[model samples]
Target: MSRLFLALFLFLLIREKYGYTNITLTVNYEKILAEVRKEFLSVSLDTHLIQLNWGGLNFENQRVQRYARNLAPAILRVGGTSADSLYFKPAFGKELASKNILPCYDPCNCDMDYKTVETFNMTARQWHQLANFAQRVGWTLLFDLNVLDRHNGSWTGKNAELLFDYASRKSVGPVYWQLGNEPNILPHFYNRSINPSTLGRDFLKLSTIVKKYKAFQQSLIVGPDVTHPKQDMNSSKPMKYLRAFLQAGGEALDAVSWHHYYFDGRQATADDFVNITHFDSFKEQAKLVCSETRRILGQKKSVWLTETSDGYGGGVRNLSQTFIANFLWLDKLGVSAQQGIELIVRQSFYHGCYGLLNPNLEPTPVYWLSVLHKRLVGTQVFNVSHNSGSKIRFYSHCGNRKSSLVVFGMNLNNFSVGVNFGKELAKVKFRVFIWTEDLVIKGFKDIQNKFVKDISFEMPPKSIAFVKFRKLVGVQACK
Candidate 1:
């Protein structure tokens, strides 16, 4: 009896050990979790650029246009904390002039010297340049209006009407609109506090203004952009604010939007980027937002991660700008899709530490990942289940090719993990791409031209992998 017991214990231990090393992934192709927007992954530009007069952007630069084109079929969001203070000089009334302005020396001398930090000005010329640039880049423009402009504690929206009137006259085309930027955190940054109910009424007024313009008739309105739910005195708790906003004027919004960052940029460590617990936190936050939105507004209105990154304060210095950041970015895309987020606008295209490209317009690891995602993955997502638990994070999607499917995931383990596809993907030919921890890409070759009975591969530790089955047998969903 003792010998038999010892043998059973050894067998069980061996099974457990091998099971963890070899992850088995199965996808339910028929069960589509969600269909992401065609412009699912978008990018944003901080209005701070215009407020600070940081040379704005050399929209004429070939390199800049080239990189921007790569992220085409996206929404170019013009918003940030500075957006709340932005004033359209074309429509600046005498009443707005009474507010104290934060002055600065303009480096470009774009005639922006007269503005203050509390009241930065955007000229008509700058507006046309930005609108033209968005048109030229084949991107949809989502502009955020100044919500802090008030008269007797009510949003006047006179400036927003003037800006929209100018755009309509110029035929600037359709523009998605938002009322503010991170309204929950306004008290901390701007010493201004507007409750959610008041903000909702403000949104209703803004919606009325937007409808007045012929050019914006078909445009979408999204808002009450807030950060993750946090119980801090500096900001309104995001969930509470959102509920109040929706309750007051939920019908005014076309979509619900929010922002997220896994860690604070100033205090992030390299290890924090790859922490599994941190990823779980992100998932939980997303789930909470989705559930709350559905409960309040129902499924009619979609949710958006309009502004997000690795860390909030301009991103982490070395960690966010490195290849390690792909773990979070990739995981974010996968999780966002699963949670029914229609759109995720990455913070910036070219301005900060979190920018996909450096000042020189060179690609980062996340940029390449975006490229691969755009070229290979489709809108329809398949439900993927893996036996290796959280050690291997996996997502499956219908590929861009005819009768094809793609399985992409990250291996968070410090040691390489092996992947074994289910029988449904057996006898399939695939090409693989693996981005390693050292920022080098490996494994781009096709396994074989002929069908393989069983497909298996090693995922390098702390790396991302994409396996595309050129012709996934018996998968009718891709059709």
Candidate 2:
């Protein structure tokens, strides 16, 4: 017995030195912190400023709607760069107005007058169609109102009021409103800037319009909707903008909103997706936002990441669309929820380089990962810790239905590693599901009953595993 104990200790010592030991994952089921909100995972769409009719056309497609419905009970945000300059046509059935169609050398800035700015028109029929689709898919519409119209720095509320009036008459599914997209960075793209006080005043004006309508009275008003923070002084910093906006219009906001991207798409790589440090940095940034929100709004308001993908600028062509993106996607879900973010709106559902569904309306690897996350992980988030290296990242949540606890692990290393659940859980039966290279999904049966303390399995390189335990002994949180 003494010799056996010595040998086991030496084996563990050598494995630890070489970083080959089984990762001991500890889940404290009793330590439930937050109830993950049902709408925590949502999606957004680019409206192309209502021009090109991208928003109206995409949701109407049967295949697109069907794929979206799979992730039901989500928030569908319709806005992007185009939202900042979107124009409205209030006259019902009026012929669509034509733009000057300037041929500017710079794609970012196409200088034009107010008449040309109203490039896209959302007819009454299209509005009704979008509303009906939202209702059918069990999603709420988060419509972005243009703040940069001819009204100057302030929102005139004419087009917004018209939209609300139409929505109320049609009884659209609970429509929430965001003032604009990436307001902090507007100067860089549109050569226009609105001070926080001006934005606050505009929000108040919109709120007054909303209160006049019966259907919109209870609708949420979320904003600032700024881009992520930047280190450079020349770039826009969302936190600084958020502080100013909250001070000026803090009373008007229902939720604080912002966007995040891991890196620039031009330089992004698959290795970046699996790097644990990259996710750690993201968590720190989220923490900073959380701290700022508490300082400004106390506990009354919640923070939301309204637009985020693996990389900005449409995301990397191959990395963002392939199976490796799941590592970043899943990690974002787990870490964001843990950091107290109320919701995470993925940059897009479709119609972008980083879309979860391809142009053919087929599910991408990220979409499959999302389906598994929604179906397996429940509302309650449990505490999970790891004793191994950074290559293995672990998260725990209460199971969806029959299962008691769901454990998710991401293997970032190039080699397989074993995962041990400790002796207390050795006898328990677990169902395992894996997503790896080429978007392949595989499942394995229960671990053999003979194992006393740990279970050894080869978690392939750059893979993720979802392990569900049948029952937990005394987890009141699961109940």
Candidate 3:
């Protein structure tokens, strides 16, 4: 695990300008995590990443770095629905009982747009572009197999397998596989009402055939990509079918995959993303699925988030730029890490309220926070103490031989704090940054305004700020 670093501001004029604000951070070099992480950890992403089709990576060919960096090597996940549309062309659309393919959209007839023509004009080439980009960036592939094949109620893994072979033919390392996006969401997505047992059976069958491919020995097979099995608000609970699937010889599967929306549903408000207390409500949901898997599969397997976004369906504009979004992302990451899961793939690097970065490749507040976390927080558990006001909270990462204090304080109100970090005085360095306004799409001033020069300032009405500190051997500290 790496500590995420947040860039406060890089002065264009590289000479350390004097009269700079002395924002002090306290670090205790004496304590570090006792349990060293044997393996380095990072994120995993869906096939389509930020700046790709949905977010338009080459839309303008802006050629900025990070939006693409968001998906490379560090994370690998397949974007399901988007891929389903292209790959799930119904060869026999009229015969299927389900209105759409297993994961197809409302306008099931789009198949003719591409199916009628061999070129697949309707396919989201953006995904191909994404895979190409990932490949170019030295990434591995885990292309999602088609669950919604065009011939009604029928599906095949041939095209998908071939697609993976095509996508990563020139690349190195083991390829990964997932039969469907989220099988639990299958019935609702395709307008079919199959129970979990049927979905599981289908998944098992799909996995069985896929494993026969030559790549099976070298690739990763992940399944049971469900979302919210606890309430079963709209689909069949996977546990029932999962047991049956395994009973029917689905053991060739390598990993358990799924999705999680902070609060189930889309287009939610920022307030919805910010409420951590609501998470307590989902704990039992996590427990149930984990326990079920343990009962059937065994303990200590792998659990991954194939998809997750704070607000729904990409989300609205400003919520992503709010204090709420900041707290929400942090809460999610902390929870996921603390849960001790194997990997967590963020919903997207772009296109949603929870996008770590924007379509233009600029870092969102959450992106900065995410970077900060990657640079500072490690596998070590640190004991922390802080006050929980409506917006601000502070905590310290307790390491066995070194400690780092992270104080993410939200000034939702009119006041600020001047704090003290114990006897580790004169051993801290600071990095501070701020997000003061919403992202404006069509404003000239929005693009031309001078970057702020002030160091200490009031947090704008809904903005979020980031300040980080690295403890050194001889830095001075506040009394």
Model 1 per-residue lDDT tens digits across residues 70-167? 77788989998878888887843322122343323222111222233456688887787788888888889999999988999999998988888788
User: Please, what are the lDDT tens digits per residue for candidate 3 over residues 234-340?
Assistant: 44666565566555434646667667666533445556654646555445555665666666777656666566656444544577644456655665554454444
Error of 1 at 322 (Å): 0.9
**Candidate 2 Cα misplacement greater than 4 A, ranges:** 1-19, 55-60, 91-119, 150-152, 230-233, 423-426, 439-456, 471-473
Top candidate, metric lDDT: 1
Residues 238-314, candidate 2, lDDT per residue (tens digit)? 77888888888877888888888888776777778877778888899888888888798896578888999887767
How many clashing pairs per prediction, in order?
2, 0, 38
CA RMSD, predictions in order: 6.0, 5.0, 11.2
| Cα TM-score per model | 0.87, 0.86, 0.63
Clash pairs detected, candidate 1: 102-116, 102-117
Distance from true position, residue 53, model 3, in Å?
Answer: 5.9
Give the CA lDDT, 0 to 100, for residue 479 in model 1: 82
Whole-model Cα lDDT of every candidate shown, in order:
0.78, 0.74, 0.47
